[model samples]
Target chain A: MSFSRRIIIPLGFVLLIGYYGQAQSSYQTGLLPALNVNTKLNRGWSINFKFESRQQLQRGIFGEEHDQDYEYVLSDLALVAGKKIGFDQSLAGGYLMRFRGQDMIHRLIQQFTIVRRYSSFRLAHRIAADQTMSAGASMTLRLRYRLSTEWPLKGQSVDPREFYIKANHEYLNVLQGEDYDLEIRFVPLLGYKFTDSNKTELGVDYRLDSFLQDHPRQRFWLRLIWYRVF
Target chain B: MKYIFPLFILVLGTFQPLSAQLKFEREYRLKSREVPPAALEFMQALPFTKKIRWYREEGYQRTSIEAKTKHQSKRYSIEFDTSGQIEDVEVIIKWKNISAETRQLISKQLGQNHQRFRVRKVQIQYTGTPQALREFIAGTSDESRVTIRYELIVKAKTDGQFQRFEYLFSEAGEFIKRALIIDQNSDHLEF
Candidate 1:
């Protein structure tokens, strides 16, 4: 398999159910943009309401956008906590939920993520299970190295903010009687932060699929994110 | 790609300041000298008081002041045998760019908060990520730096004289909790 052909093979025809939860362009997102509202009730607990009204705009691995018509509303309550073990051991976790009216269909989901930070970069492993009998896992390996020239912009000081561009890659492998598999995203990002809590990110997303040599489809988007105090 | 240890080092180093907490112990020491009538007359008039004992750890600020009263008949010890007695006295004054005038003006505001705000061991905490903290508050964040300052302070009066009027005027201004001392019986101090 040529490199591009290998990449598209999975990008075009993905296994029955496989999503790494990248929060990027989706077959259902173009028609129904989603709204997420989260607030801090106190210290350890938080409530998040999600309203998604768009369909996925799947722009095959390379060519045109394929409209995947679907919508659902999801309400997720999360309990987050971090524990430090010994001198070099630490753990951070989030327990989440999905409700009906949040995005379109009435479905529930549970996702668990665990990460380990080394001297240079952090590695993440995530597992998500849907109401249906489909279960999947995603593995992401990203390298974050600090750059010197970038100072922080105004409006951020309460937390330590760092500037680094990372190379991100994800893979999803599923099993259900037969191999319905493959999809991957290769993104190079130019990211910056204001204080420590606010973020401004920009990047290019390159995708590859399975069947029609999942054509190499790419796009650009900007994202803004804020986290509540813990 | 470089040293994985360095990345873990980065995260661990960020949380260092969270544990550098401050502890305030209760203690105080008081001294006075009468030029002619008032201070002397007050000491002399006291009945059955023992003379002074010059001690370093007894709460005296300096040995020079301790020497001034050494062997002098006027020197006397005032001891309050309570468990939380003023063990040592220190006056720590912090000159922050705080709006003292603004706080004074908020007297009415505090009155309106009669239900929400109550007196207790006050601890003020600020939580946010370095990147976001500097962005939300103007001039707070570096281009991509994180390390915001969080501070806590405890203050009490020098004499515990909450009700009286005159004790408030003494030149002894200090952060009573961290700097000054008070006797539970000193009706002149307000905390």
Candidate 2:
């Protein structure tokens, strides 16, 4: 197949899907900014810290002919220690602190990741489980599975100052107070590696929460992330 | 219609896999400043430059520097040693560019050397001083003044095993050197 057909068709498909879904669901636009710092201590040991801020549109979901207003919804900071267990496999454990509308929650998380490469792209699989605790709310346990893929737009590999694309989907199962709910998320991102130590990503986060109060809730958020390596 | 589109997208997006053949090749990008000044200066002298990229490759014994660029609708790659000395300059060429005699010689050599082999890539290379190349590229010197070689990437089956090797041959298709690739590590995970 030609390069144009391989690229243009898939991109057109993604845009068509995004446009078609907006007409079906109550979609709200939000903003997320995140910073991630990674430090490698040795061949197997690594440390990472991440801070993210999430803001939601104040108006109703998909309100027309109105001024755009945004309000802070939540913020989170997390620290993780990771160790390589096998080739292309790693295990990480972390602690996260979240602040949402004057309420705080502490979470403990463990994750396992496996990555493999193909001709011009890479595939990553991550499975994680976390426990969340709050002063007044019930304790919650969540399990998540995410599959991600990335491809370089040029050359054999993604070089410095080159463009790439990433697409990922995640499934979440939440257990709280004898009740369980499920969530699914899709993200399509465009990324650029500015230098060996710096990179940026911009994407859309589309999430659907099923069985939330017996009704499905859909959200669309704009996500921007920065990565720095030390 | 409301749910069908999303369902179709979800199914298609989640299951579609990249369909392409992979070779045992990789590269690590380097900064322009990280390249040796003398080599960079020589390459920049070429005309109609579009893009210049630097890479570091640890092959066989020493670390080699590669500067890849596109000029006049053709790809040019120049290799240099640690001290900015020119190793070779290679350009993308068509398969028909090799003479019939040279092709026959190459096939005979491959038949004698391996049970079976497949060609993956080919490049026309020039081995000479940086100054001579600059003058040649600048159209001030004749092409015959510089020595030309052929670089071929082939997957050869030897002793009932298939392995990829980089092969160099003289203009007359006489075998010169062959380098075996031990690993395909391109710093893919660091970023």
Candidate 3:
């Protein structure tokens, strides 16, 4: 009875299946394909949970045409708690889960992002953290800024069709070269506004890249983007 | 021969614009140091990051990484000679963050949508070479449609997350309205 055949066979099969699914998921994909679940649990409170299997491959079979090629896949989970200070300013913080392959990365990063909104502009800043993967770890002391903008086209269409733009800038002072580098993007976004409390974002964005000194070679080239929010 | 080469260099260098814009279309394997003293000097001044092995697809060269910077972001491409002398310093591109108006519009759109619409799919493509985008949009004297386009999905209040917005940008990276793509919704809203 202690070693019941029923329990043994099914348990062993389940374990085998779990192991196989995980095994095949590796090397078979570019990055860890995961899911992102975002919910507004309550007013001024939200949850951003993500789970990704992290595995970064630099210079794989895809690197022949180019010199360097890599991909990063990761899963994370986070709970955000915040309150609206002003009519449009929101302050929030949360926890996240870092995953590598089938293993869970233990580094926890506590982040504070300021979601400040004006009647016409909404600016979000990381306030404290540089390209960090570890908890409370910041790369450089300089501040990193990310700015996003949108404009509604009037008389053009009765629809909620508006324009969208986003910008991310990183200030780095490495090896004593104080520098500021920026990457800006703009998308003539089309939004659908509802009479009540419904809105949707649909548009294509053109990404143009520019690099200042204190910077390096990157995709700061022109790119195309397709985005949807409904 | 040496004297002639130097003379030619001086003549062309003098006529070059005070500031030139660089494009990635020229070469896949970018190595100004690919030649001589320029490489030697850049290597010497190579900041700590300069040693941070970067390739065409990886490192800072990743197209997406560059695209993520602000619209007003600026990139510089410098070439040095074997003797460690500066050969050329050109502004690859300069961009500023999207206008404040544009950002507000996106925030409003992302904030109000109540449903999770399925992405039929997504893609962005360059109309042609940077020169082509410049020539097509610039060669014309009018401010009409440009070669560069912004194509995206548009949703309808009718509840179907279906719609498309296509905008064109000129070679100078300015918005062009005549090139816009707009259509009507099936269950149009009658307000």
Candidate 4:
């Protein structure tokens, strides 16, 4: 097939799927903007900070006449210290202070990550454990695992001014006092490498929260992140 | 039966068989700082070369530095390692420039190794130059003394699968070695 045909075919199928698969689920759209900074303290240690904002969108991206109604859902600041373990592994611990409307929560987080490379694709696996605390709410413990893959769209490897694609899937298990819940999230992002030390990503974060004896709640999130290294 | 055919198409589309692949090449320019100092020094020492530029390339375990320059009527590319040791010097040449005897010999070898083969790109390479490298860097040697080699990038079928391979041969068309051309994947450093 010709180059134009190759692209037109898959795109045509996607449009067909969109036209036919119109079943709507119980989900809310959220927009998140975040800035992440990593400052290297030494050869082995680095500190990372992220400021994040979550806004609950009242309408979809295509709903133009709705006047862009949205509400500030939550915000958080996270700080983490990472230590390089080996060529392709790292260990990190962090803290998060979050405010959802009027309620505040604190979290302690620890994680380990390993990355492997395979012919134009990078695969990364991260495991994390955290504890969350609030004034009147019971303490919560959560364990999560995420697997991600990244590939350069236009070159053998991503470099400055190049575009890449990253996709990840995460599973989270939470225990609050005696109640247990599970959440699964999938994110597909397109990223641009502005320079060696800067990158930007735009993606959709789809999350499904399942609780015992309750119908699962779905969250569709538009996520944008800016990453910088110093 | 209705579900089986749709499922088959989905599976076939999602999981591509390990057969022939589409090959592509795209070069990214690197900053001067990214180029190793040793590779830069070696390039500076070459005589009669002008309009030199440097780049760091992917698709290799060790860092590879590529320097392109115009020497008289011909354009030359010299690939070096991080330590400034020369890997190969290549000059792009037309397919007809290759002697018919050598081309026929290469064709026979490819026929024996693969079910089918097609040549895609060709370069005349110079190697076996440890002594020549030292003398050249010291500004005491000429280019024509080194042994010439033919380096080819070709698509070939093997084990019922087709993939690109880089083939190395002597000027006499004796096969030395061949390596499957695979991409280099690296994680952008987080910090």
Give the per-residue lDDT of model 4 (tens digit) for B1-191: 79999999888776553222322234555566777777776666667446776766644234577887677677687888766678878887776789999999999999999887878778898775756864643458765667788888876767645456888888999998787765332222231
Count backbone clashes in candidate 3: 57
Assign candidate 4 its CAPRI class. incorrect
Writing each residue's lDDT as its tens digit, candidate 2 over A101-206 gives 8899999989888776554677778899999999988999999998777777765566567788877777899999998998777777888878666878899887
The candidate, 3 or 4, that scores higher on DockQ is: 4
DockQ for the candidates, in order:
0.01, 0.05, 0.01, 0.05
After superposition, the stretches of candidate 4 with alpha carbons farther than 4 Å from their true spots are: A1-25, A59-69, A211-214, B1-26, B29-126, B129-191
Worst 10 residues of 1 chain B by lDDT: B182-191
Report the number of the highest-TM-score candidate.
2
True contacts kept of each: 0.00, 0.05, 0.00, 0.05
Q: What CAPRI class is candidate 2? A: incorrect
lDDT (tens digit, per residue) of candidate 1 on B24-132: 1222222333122233332343342455322212222222111112122332222222221211111122323224653343323333423222222222222244224
lDDT of 4 at B39: 73
lDDT of each: 0.30, 0.74, 0.33, 0.72
Candidate 4 local lDDT, residue A74: 88
lDDT tens digits, residues A138-184, model 3? 33232333333333233212333333333333233222135344433
For residues B30-121, what per-residue lDDT tens digits would candidate 3 score against the true structure? 33333444344343343323222111212112121011111123233333332434433223221223345643443344335523322221
| Pick by TM-score: 1 or 2, better one | 2
**DockQ-based CAPRI category assigned to the predicted complex of candidate 3:** incorrect
User: Which order, best to worst by TM-score?
Assistant: 2, 4, 1, 3
Model 1 TM-score, 2 decimals:
0.31
Which ranges of candidate 3 are over 4 A from the true structure? A1-37, A41-43, A50-65, A68-72, A106-121, A124-126, A130-143, A153-163, A170-230, B1-191
lDDT of 3: 0.33
Ranking by lDDT: 2, 4, 3, 1
How good is the docking of model 1, by CAPRI class?
incorrect
